[model samples]
Target chain A: MTAQPTQTGKIIISVDAMGGDSGPGVVVAGIAKSAKKNPEVGFLLHGPKDVLSKLVSKRRVLDGRVVFRDCPDVVTMQDKPSQVVRSGKNTSMWSALESVRQGEAHGAVSCGNTGALMALSMMRLRKLPGVNRPAIAILWPSRNPQGFNVMLDVGADVRADAKDLLQFALMGASYARNGMELTRPRIGLLNVGTEEHKGRAELKEAHALITDFADQANFDFVGFVEGSDIPGDKADVIVTDGFTGNVAIKTGEGTASLIGDLLREAFKYSPLSRLASVLAITSLQRLKKRIDPRRVNGGVFLGLNGTVIKSHGGADATGVSAAIKLAFTLAKSGFAEKLAARVASTAELEQDAAQSALQTK
Target chain B: MTAQPTQTGKIIISVDAMGGDSGPGVVVAGIAKSAKKNPEVGFLLHGPKDVLSKLVSKRRVLDGRVVFRDCPDVVTMQDKPSQVVRSGKNTSMWSALESVRQGEAHGAVSCGNTGALMALSMMRLRKLPGVNRPAIAILWPSRNPQGFNVMLDVGADVRADAKDLLQFALMGASYARNGMELTRPRIGLLNVGTEEHKGRAELKEAHALITDFADQANFDFVGFVEGSDIPGDKADVIVTDGFTGNVAIKTGEGTASLIGDLLREAFKYSPLSRLASVLAITSLQRLKKRIDPRRVNGGVFLGLNGTVIKSHGGADATGVSAAIKLAFTLAKSGFAEKLAARVASTAELEQDAAQSALQTK
Candidate 1:
């Protein structure tokens, strides 16, 4: 494959070509698809040069936009997050993130072990100033007019104190604004019940803190929201600790897929139903497209010095392309820089809220 | 309404008729539906005698099997759990639970405030011996041959320690056995990841304790399961703290409904799609029935001294009847007594595991 000259004004995404369940070939193919649609997008692909070259050579769309780096090592799924951080210097994941840190790429995309990728990204790009814990934000298809809602802290860690939650609210607001193009996104704290007196102690404290910052942050604080409201129009951004958010998103995915599978089974039950299925195939396809998880396949790592999008480890070519598109959008919109400024501006207000909570206790 | 003598061998359920979102009419209609199908089922309906008599008189199937207690007070949804425990003696919710405690009914069903109902039940019936916390378990529709999987503590409380999780697992296993009739139910600890090393410290401890007790408890322990597995066939029962379980189940419900709404919108998008929808109406109805929330509407409060099923507050006749049927099945199967015995037998083992966890800490 011929190496292209670096385009001065293009949005360069550093792609980690190793560690995906479907292998680097799928990643390369996905980037080629994105490059064809997005003429302004370029790639600094990191993997074994020989392997990546062979794959990229097969895709004509990638000829003028791809640059390959020979990083022979790979991060295995079994590798612990701590082990990867300490010993994965030569791996493709490390190289991809390093390119972002060094300003060679605007952002990075990885379809690898989530824990390992998160660890490497944090170590390489560092957290934005005044942010306590970074969060993973994903767009959930919802009943809203926009057809998507943002939910954050989907598993960067298992815990979040009141301060971390306040930061999540701000970071999430910034993400919704940039990604969803909302001027004032509605933010809700995820709890067991929507009532004010429900949920854990930290969540209650976090609710108060977020309420205090809502006006200054320029987002509509919708108070406490139950899990059902996460996919409803009640809130554009739902904030929770990583543990709850992680479980909720996965459960939602699982339930939707189960229903889809059962619907197919119902259509195949008899000759009459099968005839109906054939006649209804086009309408079903439209419905399928509306709810397809692959259409929104990236989880953006928020509150970092630079943005990094984590594609599903087992994502196919279309899913990978979706992640690339997300990275390109965030980079072009300067989401990482805007989010940093949002969190930094609220640092004093968060400290005041914490002090008040401590005084009351 | 004509009064009748209490039957000698019928299974009577105490129904709290005052506080449902749809009022006593729906509850009375529901019990009448259940009574029509099962001659052995009866109801000790708790509400104002004059009001219930008018509703029962409208349902011909309820004529001979209904009995009413004149509890004029009602438990409002806004009543605090603590407040209800103190001053709810005259309320219909309290009367319904008291009947179960007094052995006048085999089990109880309530559609009032969850917090109020749970508080009254715990105070009245008390926790089973050696049970630290009682859980509310619900059957989630799934791909299992039995068509459902048991998940608990869907919200009796927001917290559960390692010992509490162990209790939930044992209780959930018993529920699966009695409710779904799995001889040796597969029990899984719900966590962020399926890997043993990938969650909170309490979850790790709970995993170890549940693993150790699996053999003696006569349930198969599937080490750790993620939210995706909640609706899958990998486990017959999924256990978690009430906070996580509550959020997960609600999130799953919300996602399913969102998809359902979107599917309808897709089918109505154009004349061609609308025509296709008409042809596929039968297949669509079959699919809808399979995933209807009303078909499995009850949340059974497990590990309590007596059984109590909490129906959805806004449940229609069909949903209320589903809850009644669940209560009836648990009563006939002797679920509460069996669960109490299981917990009593496991007391020594849980104590040992707690001690081990403490020593390790």
Candidate 2:
């Protein structure tokens, strides 16, 4: 609705206003909520300019805080990741990431298809120097003092070799430091058991490589962990290949959803139980808030040239706001810049490890 | 304890009494519960003679139904699987499997270390004629009419090829029919997405092979299903490789545990909330009972020559009984014999599929 002034000093996030299941209206509402809360945060919203303007008009709080980018095409969930990279230039998700790439926005946030977003981000922003495949990292609710643990490669590339895994450990450790403000993070490679000879061949190799890299990278290597330890207090960061990580997270989410649905059903069984539900509403709400997926709604793409956070495709207003808040915080912290510096040194060290491994053999 | 007379005509199961966290006392209690409930079921208990006899003597229901086997050694949870396969002869777990191998018991049940148990089963009983990898299938609580869905390769082996996955489909379907009594089970391959092109290379090959053999195998192929669909009402059988499957189930269990802990903490926050928890105890208990992991505690090893079930290593009396009941049901159904007949025809079909693919190329 208004021409944006020079907010070059402020942390401006490139927001994809389309592609999410809740549509652009909720996206506007989410950003408006964020803008009202943080004076230093602004948004470069990408969508159909006319449609987004009408939605923004209703939210007077976002009158001067938003800069609209007219992206005519919207990326659908059904679109293949490879196809989108070739011909999805005008899509809101693409435009949103482009703003960050072109230095028009500090970082980008999108509630879109995970595969497509990761593919587009890699192609547009390119990978960091030594990063073979980019990873998607998310904060899992945990028993730790930080309230959450980080798990990587949730749904990026489906494969990661020993060297790639070594990179993930470094990138993940860096993420913990910048994102969670932890000085030294505990890194664990996800396996079936905490045994030396357990899991796949690559895992065994990765375990050896990561153990060597941990001290140099300034993180504690908790050699191996099982799926249960992902949410447990054993490690602050759990690293696994994209395929396993994706299934594991989805399974966790599915189980949580099932428990919630079953609890609601339990509370509705009788008239007395229905009255008990009202009395326990506050208590149940507290439990829900603590484990709410929406509260920690951003999946940050690691090993990227720029900061990109992928919000849940079905995210509502609250979820979208959570993603926006995360992007703003990371952008302010200059997490991506610092991560690049850290990984730049990793290439030489990885090569030396490879050389030593070969020589020893 | 009274000596068992003629269990040759009964559904006698070889029970490993020394492995579970609760020890032989709970194992004895579990079989007593089973023996009391089902007069036809009996046990060939494997453990130290003196210890097992002392425990079983206390349970009057198992007086005539139990036969003691003197096994001096016990398989600890930390025992290496490979080492156990080579030299764990006198251990209770090995003795338990030997009974099934020698045709002295209809089936075998153990609460030993999973990897060790699987290794011993393969070494003692061997694989079926056409099956490459044996799978550990468990009943996952779902919203289906049967209230559970079968998921395979939970941790039998960490790797499986395309052919191995097709066999998993056949074996999982067979498990659904016998274990859950589903006539024609609907099978879905686990992946990150339902798209045919998604997931690792082996999954795509498995998808094509499973689809081709679905009709011949007498199971409905639901193409690809995501991790969320595991607990959903979509399919009766969900198949995946052991590595991914293991992570998924463990992740699901971990999330459930987290929610349970948080719910308990939430209820203790305030006096009113504590009062509300008391009024809602019945409702909460109902929810807990519906999804109790101990209630459905057996992980059946399919693609093996004989029936073997691996119970949770930490199982108490209730969990142990659940595994025993499952063993009794499968033993009575002659599920192993029926599955063998079905898989006998599969070897020829698989060979033909491979030949056709090679010729076409």
Candidate 3:
């Protein structure tokens, strides 16, 4: 491998410059934004050297701060996870993840196919010990004082059983601590109701299991929380099966976008309304900043040996930069190591709880 | 039995006036608004005679348009469904459903505990001939020209198999035709992904089954849709199990409420924004009216012997009125009989499809 540009002692982020809806240029711009804001961060940009070089050379802030890797293949959104795992070695997404696997970068950031990224991530970085299923955790804007709550298993897999949910609680709590800097984050299992008897059969089982681990895990178990409580400050870490979590997140996002569109149309209905919009533009912008999905752009892959942050496929420069910032923070804090340690003890907790239950019986 | 004041040949509606969070006062006010706007509709108000009479007497429009049923008990929100089923015969919710069961009222409307109401509905009204599980269908604001789309199984039974989902599609299509007045409504099965192999095993089976029944059922099968399409224009009717549907709806509502609250806070942050708010009051009101959850407040119980509308428990008089309007429309259209006819033939269709599959095999 050729020696590339680097800043001594600066944290390096592996960036997949291809496969985003906005193309490689936007990815380059996003890394440049991060590079300008944080002088202590550099990038391992993976994509076509000819295209990436042109884009990187144009950004003055990125001078001597980026290492370019020539990865000619790109993973499309439509590619199946299984297909990508078998034949995607040359893709930018795979190459980017390779840097993290080889310890050449602190973490990897990609705006590629989510399923494929997760699949490649699992193959390249490997699952941490004691994790049956690795999960993707994202920050959801909430009524909490910290302004965001962590939700997990958003789209890692469609199904999660009772034991899986217990592990999610462990991982989510870890994320809330290291990622959000919360000392003792409260975990809530997502269900149809807060009542113990409500929801699927597995939820009742998961409830008991999560409650058993909370004390030892150093996080408070808030018990069951309904979907309405997701953004209502009931819990700092909302946990659920990926199918339900994915649906809930997308539904929330779709509703917000619809309202935003309607709000703009409402303001444009008349000349007087248009004038009001102009006057209130700053306030509207403030509101936009408060609830913007773009600000919380990264989905951190938990229960993995190396950190991987998945940015939204359609994320623009601002959104991508927000994701990079999140990746840098997690990498700097050694979030992957902490999360691995937390997950590694899950089996011990379960075995102890089981033994105590036998004694009580 | 007390004699009711009524206009000759007016449609009668069964209404639980006690179980709502707002009390009988709001229920009486709601029916009164309905009476004033719709002269051809009357109500059987179920509650304590003395208490309901006092509330109804204050509304001038309801002077001669309501029948009072002296049901003395009230079902609070905390009541268990099974407990209510065994011991709730005297409660207003049960009494209201009894009216629909005995054909005294065309349909039943309630703003009470959803589970209790659904249980009482099934026990009192019973399921249609071929439905394994009943569903609650609600109108969601969407980009369609009709301004809303229909979604089902919001909070009925949490579990729905492939056959149950097929029944939901038939019932949802019937609702769109009757409720939304769409001739041939398009139906989409909700999943985490639009891909055929992405969701649960049952979803794949339901997808094929829905596609098979679409043409004969008089609706277009739009195949699979993601949660984001719940508010999109991809389909007129979105179908899912009660657990997923309930989460999606509540998550959407919770997110919208949070955004609305944040928008208000943003406007209040500055004196300039305060001035802009005053100028944009009309535009803001216009926007509020367009997406007001209160305006679309009813969740219709499908595949039942009689129509039942479950309004939001926290709804005010306006939301109650919206539900009553829905009950009135469905009652006027003789929706129960049409839906019965549609569902009555589902078993036959399934049997025929089975025969065809056997022949092909």
Candidate 4:
């Protein structure tokens, strides 16, 4: 374990520079971009020192800001989560997470295998005091004034019981506060319908538990929200089991991409539409930027002992930078500690609520 | 129940002309549109006689095709499924379904509450022999050359066990063969991942059961598919529990609408872009037609004794016409009888497979 570095008015993010689809080049380039914009941010870059040094030396913005750790092992996309946890101690992903675990860095970011990263994170950071399972929270582009809504348990595991859902609500609310700067974010339980009697029995039980703990958790419980409400302003945080959340997120993305492709094809259908496309190129670029998945590229592992931002495996420089920026923001806000304390304080109340709700059922 | 109308050359469709958000006017106009194009189709219009008679009398296309059945009660959107089953006998929705049950009409279409419509259909028409649950299958615009993929169990029930999923596959395959004119539809069980070990326990059980029964059911079982594959060319039919299917459908719709609005806003951002919009309007309309929900407005109730198409509650004249056209197509092809036979014969195999899969687990 690395020694904890004293705070010196700067935030240090541990970056796993290997395992991403694009390799170490994009990760170093992304960190350089973030460093240029945020003078208060520094990086503990993890990978083979020789390779990372070559990339970092080419980028002037990275000068005096990157501390390289020599880690030759890489966790491939094919590696199972369990396999990685057992024999991946020397890998860059593990080393980067170690920096956060040891308190040497404020947080960790990886653009690697999601399952493996999540496994290593849970093994290394462990679950927060009472969290039965950790969740991965992502910021989805939405109709909210803030432009995004937080959805959790996107794929940490397939199932979430009533108690687990209550924990997700608290964690998601906390993330919304720190990540999106929302105060007392409105929370909604994701369901097939907004009606109380609708959805699976577990969802109904979770709804009651969340409602019972809403005031104590310092968030407004907006009750049930449907899939269409994911982008609507009806809820600030949508909570569900990983299975539904994962499917909904992917479905939304697939639909957006499909529509986007059709739009492009439509624009080039005829010579007249082609000329119009040129004239509207600038405005179209603006719209593209607004909905680009890269702008909200990171999925934060919540309910763990430390914060870990999982970038998309195929993220380019801009996407990686967005993830790094998120990690920096969370680190600067001391989000991990705040989240742990919040979960710890409410553990007892959540359990009581879950018990009563189940007993009544 | 009314006596079964003697089979004439024209196929008869029972239309619930009340209970839709737009009321009887849209229903009459929709039937008129369908009748204008298809002289072989006729309607058994169910609603209050004075209202429906006045509306139908004004439509020249429906002059000889419409037969009115007076049903004074309307099934409001707020009616619960159980409540509707208990005492909604005189409602237009019930009357419309009754026409199908009594064999007076080949099929039925309604734009009333989904839960209520499904309940009445299940109660009056009953489930096909050996079917544990009936599923609602919808056509989703996709990249397939056929331009659509069938997804089942979208909201008939919130949960589905292994055996129920097998039933959905069989029913969905029957629908694709009749409704979409596919010879042998490719069936994929919806899951979070393509891996066999992924998703919920029931999904794993379903994967095995579907695989075991695919040969006898006459559909190619493509195994597990992710949400992103819903619009992809990987499968012609995607089967899942109603809860997940419902959420994915709404999420897809929500995302497409959000992007469409953003594109419109972008095109109007500047005078240059506004000019571009005018030039692109024709192409845009073409694109809209390709993905219009109104074009595919009906959800077919599968595994029921009689086919019932549930149109969108808020469907306008065009949407209603699409639903009516779908009902006519299914009726003409004798889809209801085929689905019933398919489910009946395969039910024993499905149950045996489910038992084996469970015992192995």
- Listed in order, the DockQ scores are 0.74, 0.79, 0.83, 0.81
Poorest lDDT segment (10 consecutive residues) of candidate 3 chain A:
A1-10
What digit string (tens of lDDT, one per residue) describes model 2 on residues A6-68? Answer: 475567899999998989888888998898888888889999999999999999888788899
All candidates: TM-score: 0.97, 0.97, 0.97, 0.97
| lDDT tens digits, residue span A275-300, model 1 | 76777678789888877889899999
For model 2, which pairs clash? none
lDDT of 4 by residue, B216-251 (tens): 888999999988878778999999999999999998
Candidate 4 Cα misplacement greater than 4 A, ranges = A1-8, A355-361, B1-7, B355-361
Residue B257 local lDDT, model 3: 95
Task: Check candidate 3 and list the clashing pairs.
Answer: none
Model 3 spans with C-alpha error above 4 angstroms:
A1-6, A354-361, B1-7, B354-361
Q: For model 3, what is the error of residue A219's alpha carbon versus the real structure, in angstroms, after optimal superposition?
A: 0.8
Better candidate number, 3 or 4, judged by DockQ: 3
Point out where model 1 deviates above 4 Å: A1-5, A357-361, B1-5, B356-361
Q: Give per-candidate clash totals.
A: 0, 0, 0, 0
RMSD of 2: 2.7
What's every prediction's RMSD, in angstroms?
2.8, 2.7, 2.5, 2.0
Candidate 2 lDDT, B49-73, residue by residue in tens: 9999999999889878888899899
Model 3 agreement with the true structure over B121-238: per-residue lDDT tens digits: 9988889999899999999999888999999999898899988898999999999999889999999999988888798988877887777778888899999998888889999999
